[model samples]
Target: MIGQILINGLLNGFVYALVAVGLSLTWGVMDIVNFAHGEFLLWGMYAAFWIWSLVGLDPLISLPIIVVLIFALGVLTYLIVIRRVLKVSGLTALLATFGLSMVLKNLTQFFWTANYKNITNPLVSNKSFKVLGMYIRQDYVVAAVGALLLTMLVMAFMNKTKTGVAIKATSMNKQAAQLMGIDTSRIYAITFGLSGACVGAAAALMASFTPIYPEACALYSTLAFVIVALGGFGNIKGALYAGLIIGVAEALGGYLIGTSYKYLVVFLIYLIVIQIRPRGLFGW
Candidate 1:
């Protein structure tokens, strides 16, 4: 039972990490608290759903398209909306994203209604395999693996490439990066796009097993924000580790206490961690 709980928690953590890392990256570079980040995930889910429904493509096979589409949307958002607010007060920026969030959510509802939707015949849906006396859902395993790969790829992109270095430099000190001839605007756009892509990948994986709806992103988004705070805002690596921790905590808490109290346990951990380290587990 313990092992099973651990496995479930760990797998869930990978998905949470995938959701949080994008927010961390955007925060790291632009210092923008994007309230609309979850909408990107929602759109990605719809993209997968429609592609499957209309084109007969599997979510797994359509992942790249979803990523690209979301990336484009992110870049466009930066160019059109976020850029206009860059020079304004932080509160204005926050409100701008908050507005965007509401608009996206409402638009989705207007178009699709509030009905819950799911892939009826996803390739990995409802499949399970037994391992070490525990049955694990195949969709969860696949999503976990996909999330891990995406996280590693993002890490490598930030750590190894020249553009990645420039992004890191920009995040550390935008003025210094500008002095060094890095186009700050371009970097910001790229960061948002990359963030969108990360969320897109997560959405595709999640859509395989989870239901979809106009407001479906709400719970996941709230959890992602919590993960980002617990991990340390602007710290991608921290978010990764924190996500795993939260996942395990939620699983254990749900099993030991009650499913209804799972989030209570998570927030309690967050409160304790913040008291000990105000900047998060790794904010510096």
Candidate 2:
């Protein structure tokens, strides 16, 4: 019984982690907190919906298209809006992002309306597998596995590859790295684009569990903020760990208390953590 809750929590948490890590990648690399991150995820879900509807591609399978589109969007945003603001203080950057967030949100609502939306597929409804007595639906399984694989891939790239090394270098010390012949500008562009690509995957995973609504962009935006705060800013590993923690907390809170009070506990923890150690558990 306990194991089932844990597994269920973990699967849910991986989705949150994917979202947080994408946000953190930008923050860690460029000190940019993209308030528009969740909106990117929202748009990707819509993108997946259309592709699936028109071409009969499953949302899972249409992931590449969603990713490419969002990635391009991220790159364009960097070049057009974010590039000029990068040198300012964090508050200024956040203000720009917040404005962008509102713009994207209103744009989505304008085009799509505020009605609820969902996608159907075999994997989402299919009876899949049982792991540790937890009913592992196919969508959950695929999302978890995808999240894990991507996390490992990013970690491996950062740990072993040349460009990845450059990214890490830029993240840690931009000026020193620029002196070493690394194209800091290009690194920032790729980092934001990669983060946006990850947001696409997050959107696809979210479609399996929840309806896509205009408010989803803001709701998940707050959730991502909570997870990032809970886990610690600019800490990918911490975000992963924090996701499971928040997921478990939310699951247990909903089960033991009420669903309405779930975020209370999540945010309470966030406040405590941020108050005591603002840098975060793993923040560097």
Candidate 3:
């Protein structure tokens, strides 16, 4: 039973890490708190659900399209909203994102309504396979694998590509990057795009099993804030580790205590860790 719980937690941790990574990029690179980040995930899920319902494509089959769409949304967000408030003040940027979040949530509710929607069937069947006396759901396994692959892709992009390097430079010092002809505005747009891409992929992977609704990702958004803080601001690797920890903690807490208090355990651990290392586990 413990082993099974561990497996479930590990799988969930990967997805959580993917979701938090997107928020990490925008926060770490642009120093912009995107209150609308969760809405991006909500939209991605809606996109996947609608495509599956209308076009008869599996979420996995439609994954790439959804990712690209969210990427465009991210770029548009930077250009249309974030860019305007970029220099006004941190508070202004924060407020802008908050307002944007409201707009997005309302738009979704307006078009789709507050009712929950879900994909009845997906390529990955809702079946579990037993291995070494432990059962793992196919959807969970696929989601976990996809999340890991996507996370690695993001890491490689940041480390290997010229644009990635420029992004890193801008994160470290925006003025310096601009002086070096890095085109900080373009980098910012790309960062937001990348952030949205991460969440979009996650949405597609999760759509097989997760319910679709405007508020579906609300809890995820809150947990993401905690994960980002626990992982250390702007540290992708840290976010991965922190996500796993939270996933396991949540599962164990639910089993050992109760589902009602599972999240309490998550927050308690975060509080204790922050007291010891105020900069977070990976923060500099």
The top-ranked prediction according to lDDT is 3
Please write out the lDDT profile of model 2 over residues 73-149, one tens digit for every residue: 88887887788888876588778888988899899999999888777653566565876566766777788888877
lDDT of all predictions, in order shown? 0.90, 0.81, 0.93
Superior by lDDT: candidate 1 or candidate 3: 3
Which regions of candidate 1 deviate over 4 angstroms? none
In model 3, what lDDT does residue 190 have? 99
Candidate 2 all-Cα RMSD: 1.9
Residues 171-273 of candidate 3 have per-residue lDDT tens digits of 9999999999999999999999999999999999999899898889998888888888899988998889999999999999999999899999999989998
Q: What's the ranking of the predictions by lDDT, best on top?
A: 3, 1, 2
In model 3, the clashing pairs are none
For model 1 the TM-score comes to: 0.97
- What's the true lDDT of residue 222 in model 1? 85
Q: Which is the better candidate, 1 or 2, if ranked by TM-score?
A: 1
Leading candidate by TM-score? 3
Predicted candidate 1 versus true structure: per-residue lDDT over 1-284, tens digit per residue:
98899889999999999999998888766788889999999999999999999998988999999999999988987898899899987588888889999998999999988988888888887677899998798889999999999999998999999888999999889899999999999999999999999999999999978789988889788888888888888788888899899999999999999999988899999999999988899888
Off by over 4 Å in 2: 1-3, 126-133
